[model samples]
Target: MTAHPDRTAEGVWDLTVATPIGRIKAVVEFRRRDGALTGVASGAGEDVPLRDIAVDGTLVTWKQSVTKPLRLNLAFAVDVRGDTLEGTSRAGRLPASKVTGTRRTTPARTAE
Candidate 1:
């Protein structure tokens, strides 16, 4: 059976990227479409669409742009294992930075 969005890897990810300056926390969300992935990655108050999204086995790759800190694009490839995501992020042609994140848990809805 296909996994539901509520209980699958195709949901919100709270990620942190390790840079020479410091660690930056970001948020991303993934949705599976026809066995492929499409989503938005948010950083520095900008929500950019995930481009060139590719999935192989348990690994996924995507890219987005950052406008606040500077004008640069980031490419990310991550391996999803259980509830943890391990991966690297690349900014332009610079060396890749370590990226890690965990799936965010949704609280149960309370009926009013």
Candidate 2:
């Protein structure tokens, strides 16, 4: 069953995040289980689970740490409009960078 557009952020999202090095691409998957929201991001040969995921209206926020290409802790705040998302990611005390993402029409599959 499809989730409500305004209430749920459960889906796979393709994200383009800007960093000091360059623009990196990642896929994030959000899920709602047992009344809690959880997510994971896959990129740069790393798949890390999102922390402190909170959703309010269309606004979603989460924290993640990555250790490939660079090691940094990231905090994300995005506004979800339908299938698209726009926001910023901040690394420690550095300036925030633009972050844009779109919900994937087809969920990614693993090789079996």
Candidate 3:
């Protein structure tokens, strides 16, 4: 079997969005397993577990939920380009919020 190379979205990313309440921040990390994608979105006083993660080319989608301040579940659809990610997070029937951020570069790995 042939192994594919890593993509731009397969690393820790620092994301932010401006909302009516205030500017929110989240750290998202993604990884691929057996042709499937999985990740976590954490911030805003809570850590959220992502679900239904899917990746296609430069596009990625996932679902995350929070239960603090309120019970809310968000669906994310983002396009990864270079070191930037831009997209929206939809909550039910409400309008999607603007989501944008830059990818965080990780330190070089050392041989064991």
TM-score against truth, every candidate: 0.82, 0.90, 0.80
Each candidate's number of clashing pairs is: 0, 0, 0
- Model 3, span 13-107: residue lDDT tens: 89886555656788888777786666777786776778988767777788988775557788888888878989998878877888898887773
Worst 10 residues of 1 by lDDT: 1-10
* Worst window of 10 by summed lDDT in candidate 2: 1-10
The residue pairs found clashing in candidate 2 are: none
Q: 1 or 2, which is superior by lDDT?
A: 2
Error of 3 at 58 (Å): 1.2
Candidate 1, residue 88: the lDDT equals 97
Model 3 scores worst on lDDT over the 10 consecutive residues at: 1-10
Which is better, 2 or 3, measured by lDDT?
A: 2
Tens-digit per-residue lDDT, 1-112, candidate 1:
5444333458788999998778988888887777767888777788888898776667778888888677878899998876789999999889999999998777222479
What is the per-residue lDDT of model 2 for residues 1-112, given as tens digits with 9 covering 90 to 100?
5446435678899999987778989999998778677889999999999999988778899999999888999999999987899999999999998999999888687679
**Which regions of candidate 3 are displaced past 4 Å?**
1-8, 107-112
Clashing pairs in 1: none
Angstrom error at residue 85, model 2: 0.3
Candidate 3 lDDT for residue 45: 79
